[model samples]
Target: MSSLKPIRKAVFPVAGLGTRFLPATKAIPKELLPIVDRPLIQYAVDEAREAGIEQMIFVTGRGKTAIVEHFDVAYELESTMAARGKEMSALGPTRATPGDIITVRQQVPMGLGHAIWCARAIVGDEPFAIFLPDELLIARNGGAGCMKQMVEAYGEVGGNIISVLEVPRDEVSNYGVIDPGERNGALTEVRGLVEKPPVEKAPSNRILSGRYILQPEVMRTLERQGKGAGGEIQLTDAMATMIGNQPFHALEFDGRRFDCGSKLGFVEATLTLALERADMGADVRAMAERLLNA
Candidate 1:
């Protein structure tokens, strides 16, 4: 398994319609929706970069060009800021070099699996990562980002690695649960995966946390994959097929994750990150107290 190639590329499936966000997303991509000052896609991209991934592949849709432009140089604004001696250091991550970033179109609003498949031509035959921008991960106490942790684990056991988190047993029904096996510290061998199984038939309380390091072979499985839930090609269903053939493992994320796809989660992520910022922490705390007491 040591012969496994290093994960140099990561796919961001940002083509979702994001109907949950309504009119705001009607005109704009949900990935551009900010957690605070930075957009959700930026958090996901930063996490990929933290893991030493070289190329960032965005599987995008129409009206998602803004997501692409977010990484482009803002000549006018950047030049003006530089002329005024404003700190332009923070813009480094937004600028992507020529081959470092690539975009592929996923015209139809398919499922997560279809969105990822759109990047297969770009991905080639190498191992890659998948980052769902809506699932924003925050490293606790300045630890490694979620994807970094998974990439590290992948170095140890190289086949497939997915980020996992323990939730309530009853709540497992709401998520894709893994049938866990052979545990070594934070890493657990994934014996099987079940997507949104009923509570009575749930296998484990651990849910997939939207970060994945997958072998390219899974793309073959998805080629002829059929629709599962909601008439969409489910990524989980395709992943489950590789359990016996490949070494599948899950890392219990050493941090918190915010499902920013939901309105409540988006609000919570914004407030949480705001309260952690040095410039706004005190003010946010005061605002929270005032609101709670009001």
Candidate 2:
């Protein structure tokens, strides 16, 4: 525990062209698309911040400058808001301390592994966390954020830890399923990982929930890792190689995850978060009830 290096840096792969959202994503980065109020990326960054990450590295592509600018101080906007007596708390999450946000471009659209490798120079020789902004995870009922929960568990076991969730057995083939080794409550040892395996051959219902705390060594595997499942270098492939060599574990933390990358997921996340807000929950719920009744 004491020998392990603390996780201070987090990598955010926001470089995707966001073809899923089509025309809307044509102008805006999918990460910038709002769940309710805050953009999708902010939720991931907030979760990382809660987990004690000090530096944020964004692997961006062309037209993703807004993602970077979102964290920059808006002098004119702030002054205008101040003059108009508008509350500034809403923009608080977008603010970044000096030197906290770093951006590197991933010129080619390869895969998750390639995007992670883009941050290799900055992440040199340190354990880091990866946040996929498309996954909107909420640690409700006073529980810690998903990444924070993983960090706490990382402190105890001290190796690569991935956030896991038990999807239904029928949905096992849709995600990277873990072959279980040992289980102790929320933590499960990962013996093997199969990415989107066929339903008949799927090992377990536990799937990767898009949050990871990985040691720097995996970056080496990714460097040489060739295309696997999707004609692109998969991060799961790189991770699977490190299973026996490293202390790999999966944590089924307490949280609800919404895949905001899909249309259904985006709508679900929007309504769910909107219904959770103190200022808007009542109206949103009444509206939802009315819609259902109609």
TM-score of each: 0.97, 0.98
lDDT of each: 0.92, 0.93
- The TM-score obtained by model 2 is 0.98
TM-score, candidate number 1: 0.97
Range of the 10 consecutive residues with the lowest summed lDDT in candidate 1? 167-176
Segments in model 2 whose C-alpha atoms lie over 4 Å from true places: none
lDDT of 2 at 292: 98
lDDT of 2 by residue, 1-294 (tens): 889999999999999998989999998999999888789999999999999999999999999999999999999999999999999998888889999999999999999999999999999999999999998899979789999999999999989999888888998877888999889889999999999999889888899989999999989999888998879888999999999898999999798999888999999999988998899999999999999999
In candidate 1, stretches whose alpha carbon ends up further than 4 angstroms from where it belongs are none
lDDT of 1 by residue, 1-294 (tens): 578699999999988899999999999899999877899999999999999999999998888899889999999999999999999888888998888889999988778889998899999999999998989999999999998998888888899999999988888877889999999999999999998999999888999999999999888988999998779888999999999998999999999989899999999999999999999999999999999999
Best by lDDT: 2
Task: Please give the range of 10 consecutive residues that has the lowest summed lDDT in model 2.
Answer: 166-175
